[model samples]
Target: MRKMHVWDENNLIDISEVDRNKVINPMLVFSIKRDGTKKCRLVARGDQQDLSTYSKDRQQDTINNMALMTVLAVALDHNLIIKQLDISSAYLYADLKEEIYIRAPPHIKQKDKVLRLNKSLYGLKQSGANWQKTIKDYLKGKCELEEMRFWPCVFTKGKFLEIIVCLFVDDIVIAGNNVNTINQFITDLQNRFDTRIVNDGSPNERDAVRYDILGIDVEYKKGVSMKFGMLESLTKKLPLLGVEFKKESRYNIVPGTPNRSLNQDLDIPCDKDYNAKVNWIQRAIGLSNYVAMKYRFDIAYYTNILAQHQLYPSDAVLFETERLLQYLWTTRGKRLVWKRNEKETSELIGLTDASHAKGLKYKSQAGYFCIWNGKKLFARSTRTSYVCESSTQSETYAASECLAISRSINYLLSTLTGKKPDQILLTDNTALINSIKGTKTINLDPDIMI
Candidate 1:
C-alpha cells in the first residue's frame, strides 16, 4: 500500500498459521532517487524493542571498494563495456526462514487478519542479508558462476567469454569481453528476477554529465576514471547537518592546516544545542569518510584525525570539519584517473609516514597509501597502540603497519587475477627502510611486535 506491492491476497494465510507471539511493525521508507525524485516503499521491520531477540543475523557484506575498483580497472584495461543492473524488488525473491507476522496493508478489509509473509519484504532487518544469500546460492547453483575466494560478492564464469559480476547491495555491474555472453547473462537474470538495466550507455556522455555509482561519478573517456567531491549527495547531506554556505562564498584551499593536530586543551562551549551539533558533526564525518575511502585518498588522513575527536568534539573540531568541507567545495571537480598502463603490471606500491608521538595520548599516528597500475588503490590512517621510545621506532611501527595492510591487499589481488606481485614499499625514514631490508634492527618493545 505504500507504493510497494510486497503483499498479495493469494500470499495471505488463514488464522491457523498466524503466530501471536511474533508481531512485526511495518513502516514506510521514502527514498530519494538519483534523479531528484522520491519514492515511498513499505518496509516490514518488526518492533524495535524485539530487535535483540530476533534470531536472524542482519549483517550483510558487499563487494569491498578496493576489489570492485580492481575489477573495474581490469575491465578498463580490456576496454570492456561497463553495464549496471538493478533487481526489481530484490527483497521479494527471498523467502523468509523464520516465522514473521506483519500488519495487513491499509486497504485490506479484514483488520483482524495479520499477514504472514512468505517472502521477505523491505524494512526487515534481515531482508538484505537474506536476499544476498539467496542470490549467491542462485548464481552458483543455477547460473554456473563461481564466486571468487577472496571477495565472495564478485562472481566469475566462463573462459574467453567470461563475465564478471560486482555486486553492491541491489546494484550490480557486469563486465565482460563478449557482448553475446553478457546479453545472455542479463536475459537469464531477467527470466528469473525482474531486472532494470541502468547506465546502459557510455557513462562519460550520458545525461550530458558523467555517470555516478555509490556517490562516485565514473567517466569513460580516454580511460576509466572516477570522480566524487561535488556529488549532489554531499551537497544535500552537508546542509542537513546544519552546514550552510552562500552562493558566492569562497572555500579554503586546504581541508586541514599543515601539521595541525586536534587541540585537546580547547574546551567545548556548553550551549543548549551542543548535543545537536555533535550529532551533526558525527553524521558529516561518516558521510565524508565514505567518499574519502572510495575516491578522495588525499583526504583520508584529514578525515582520520577529525574522526578521532568524534566522541567528544570541541569547537576547534567543528572548525576543522568546516575547513574540510570548504576544501571539498574548492576542489569539487577532482578525479582519480585510472589510465591504461601499457605494461599492465599489477604490482602494489606503498608509501608510509608517521607523526611520532604526536597524538593526544602521546601515541604515534601513522598514514599509508597504496598505488596499483598508476591509480590510488587504498589509503588508511590510524592511531598506533604502542608508544615509541624514539623516532626510528615510530617509523618502524608505521612501516610494519603499512606492510601488514599490503599483504592483505596482495592476497586479494592474487586471488582475483591468479598472479602474485612483490610489494614495493616506500618510506621517507631511511632507518626504517634499512630495517625492513635487514640492514639494521633497532631495539623495540616486545609488546609492539604484535
Candidate 2:
C-alpha cells in the first residue's frame, strides 16, 4: 500500500480500546529505510485482501520513489524519524517524459485532460523508478561508490562499515557508518526531490530525554536522556513469527566461513545504521526508548498467541507500527527514575476475583490486580478456563471452577515489583474456593448441579 498518510498519528494510534474515526480506509505507508530500501505493504482490513497490489503503472512509481528516497536520505542524514513535513498541495516532484492519463477513483468522471505529474505521490508507477534513477545519478557524482548486494539491498565501504538501503519501490531504509557518506547521500537526494526541510523547528538541547533525570508526568515512563556514546543500529532478526518480514540477516562472519548456513542469509533486505540514536528530536536529553525493552514489551501481549501460530501472520499481519512514536510523543521527556528509599518500595501484592457466568466459551472470567513497590498492573483471563459442554452442566461447573492464573500473575508480579503482598483470591462460589483449598479431599461428583 504505497499511499499518502492522511491523518495525524496522535489522532489514531494512541487511541485506547474504544474510539471513533472519520477516515478508515486503506492507507499507503511510505517508510524508506535510511539506506534506500523501500517497502509497500497494505494497511487494509482482513477482507480487503481483494484490493491489494503494487501500482502496476510505471510513471507513478518513478516519481514517488525519487521523492521518497530523496526525503528518506535527508531524514537519515539529519537524524529524524516520525517527524512531519507538509507537501505543497498537488505537488508532483517528477520530471516526466511521457504524458499519462488516469480515471480518478470511482464515481468521478474521467478527466478529458490527463493529470501531468511533475512530482510523485499516492498513485503512480514508474514514479519510484524514475526518482531512484534521478537520485542515483545525482549521488553518482557526489558519493564515492563502495560495495553493494542486491535483491535484499546491502552496501559496504571500509572494513566493517556498509550502507544498506532497501527499496520497496520508494519506501526506503538507508543505513551507513560513514557520517559523511550518509550526509552527502542526503544532499544529493534533496537536489533531486524537492522536500521542505523542517529541522529548524526542533527544541533547544536542554530538554530531558528520559524523564527520570528530571521528573516525568507519567512516572511509569521516564524522560529520555542523551549520552554521547557511539551507536549502532543492528536490525533485530527474530524468528519470522508470521511473514518472513525480510529486512536483515547475519553479518560479521568471513565470506568463506563454513558456518554460512548456520546463519540464514536474511531473505529480508540487509541494512543497518551506524549513527547514534539520540533523543526524540535528534540530539537532546533522552535516548531511543530503552534500546531493547521497547520491542520486548511491545510484543509481550502477542508473544504467546503469536508463537502458537508460529507460521506467518496472514498477509494481513505484517508489522506496521507508529505506536512507539506515539509513545515517544506522549512520554517524550519522561523516564522511570529508580531511587532507593525514594519512599517507594518495589513490593508485590495481588488479588483475584471471578464471576459465576461467562459466555459461549463456557468459561468464567477471572481477573487479578497486582500492586508492587510503587507500580500496579491489572490483568484478566477467560479463554483458558473451560471448553464448551452442556449448558446446564457448563453453567454450574463454570460457577464452581476458579481459573488458576492468579497465582502465576502473583509470582511474576513479585519478581518484577519486589514488594510482595498477601494475596486475597476471591471467587463467587464458596464451593469453588473450598475445592481448590481442599485439593486433598476427593469429593467425587455423582451428578452435575446448577
Instruction: In model 2, state the lDDT of residue 23.
Output: 14
Q: Backbone clashes per model, in order? A: 0, 86
Residue 181, candidate 2: alpha-carbon lDDT: 58
Off by over 4 Å in 1: 1-20, 47-53, 56-58, 201-210, 222-230, 246-251, 266-271, 439-450
lDDT of 1 by residue, 402-424 (tens): 77666767776665556765567
Give candidate 1's TM-score: 0.87
Give the per-residue lDDT digits (tens) of candidate 2, residues 214-332: 11111111123122111112122111111232223231111112211111221332233212211112211112223212221222222222222223222121121122222333332
Tell me the TM-score of model 2.
0.28
